[model samples]
Target: MMDKNQSKRFIQFAAECQSSALYEHLSLHIAEDPELLELSSYAQKGQPMPNLIFGAVHYLLLNGKEHSLKNFYPSLVNQPETEGVFTYFKDFCLAHREEIIPILERKLVQTNEVRRCAYLYPSFCYIYDKVKKPLALIEIGTSSGLQLLWDQFSYSYGTGITYGNPRGRVHITSEIKGDSTPLLLDTAPPVSVRIGVDLHVNDVSNPEDKQWLQALIWPEHHERRELFARASQCVQETPIQLIEGDGVALLSQLSDQISTDSLICVFHTHVANQIPKEAKKRLTETIQEIGSTRDIVHLYNNMNDGDLHLDYVHNGKTYNHTIGATEGRGRWFEWNIVD
Candidate 1:
């Protein structure tokens, strides 16, 4: 549990990293406003409080809530007001206190950043190259399962060449920092299966779910919002199996369903931070248990550290390596994985 000061610091950091002037200003004001900070405490345990509070407010604004605050959000207005946003923000929360509390308590901070597939694209290529088998993808904490369709999307890492599905509806662009280049296939690898497990799965087809997911995007990030809309469309067109449950608990059961012929690749991005330490331990142990029986790859980060990691068990031997460091939104990545 984070104290109010700690929460303030976290929000400050988020504001700095997100490049959202709206959120940055609001976060600074929220840090000093005891009432708003207290209200934020209603968010579900383990959820990022700043994001939840902001999303709840954004949800209300997007869902036809009449308020002056709407004028300050870039998502809502063409020319958003720069000054006195905190006043409107505070006023909106107080006016809709009851409505906001339920949302904060219920909603999880699940932003299905589709551009993250930039790294997943190359990671899958590496897996296919090594095992010479189609990959069976099992994604933990999949909000809408948009990322489960990584192979269905196209990607470009600032190169002249395009990768993955050339005809993909969702085209993701990212920057590759550093000299090391990841093994990127011209076309996506064959996927034998796609399964996503989450405590709550947001069905992209559902209007309310779709709205909530959209609201999770920050007020100023037009690009993220656009990407989200495109990815949501892609997800609806090509659906994957989504299970509603504790992903860590369901790992063993899910892996059993995948064919042995396909290389099982269990992965999650930007999700481990929300997982409890004990659950993360259980997840690791379960993966190791599964690895003992057959080959399995686990690609994840924010469990023990922020760096992206690729861990696997091949021929009864276990291997672990930090593949790269990624921008939280997949804007850029430092690929350390070498040939």
Candidate 2:
């Protein structure tokens, strides 16, 4: 992230996060226009607003400006023909500069989509075996706790490989990267407890928050958009408890609260990338310190690994295991099982 050209770096990073014509057009548009470049320059703040370019477009779409970019966005319209049509888009964005600045100023893209659960197969598989029965799951960056109810959503990895609630409205599918897939249980584990900690817990029930969550999704991914809608409904039907605070700071106290009988497992997906390196160091140290008194399992999937990592405290040693490799959107995973 420490680059001389901040604006160029932000645009490149934002382009990678997106997969549709709207974003493609936006990238080309921002790269050429000085006004757009200046607007995107605000993202130099780093972790606070990592992807400011996308945030600006997402805010506009969520705030009833979908008409501005609907023709370019594929998910909203068929084929989405926007050939050489960046002037109007630029004008629309330029007009909404004041509205976008506030969204761009917000801290990070707090996404809580359940589609991410597709990457948790290995983590959950390990927990199901080691924990035996009931699991006390504590997620670090659990945004709205949608992924907290992972077991509730069904999944289809391939024609033969499938799991979770088959009748469930939300369905996520990942392409198999390799032959070595984890031996996942046909059914999800029995959850005795589920709680998540976040700096700002998003309530799916709230209109603005729910809309924001929807906005965070890329415009091309229609399946994910549908899955999100389904998951949001589940949020209203059965609400989850998400504590607000710094997870690394609040983890120890939260871990101590888990009952002795239940197996304590701390986990996070694509979260550590948002925090400082020192904070990540503190989180690991805190987890290991807490392990001294009780048995605890920690799992994390981040950009560094491209797979889920398991840290189990056994015989006073933290045995680390490389579980599996998955796509950014959980499109596929090549599971590497030690056992």
Which runs in model 1 stand beyond 4 Å of their true positions? Answer: 1-3, 6-11
TM-score of 2: 0.90
- Worst-scoring 10-residue span by lDDT in model 1: 1-10
Give per-residue CA lDDT, model 2, range 29-67, as digits (tens).
566566776776665365433355665676576566745
The global Cα lDDT (0 to 1) of model 1 is 0.88
lDDT for each of the candidates?
0.88, 0.72
- For model 1, state the Cα shift of residue 74 in Å: 1.0
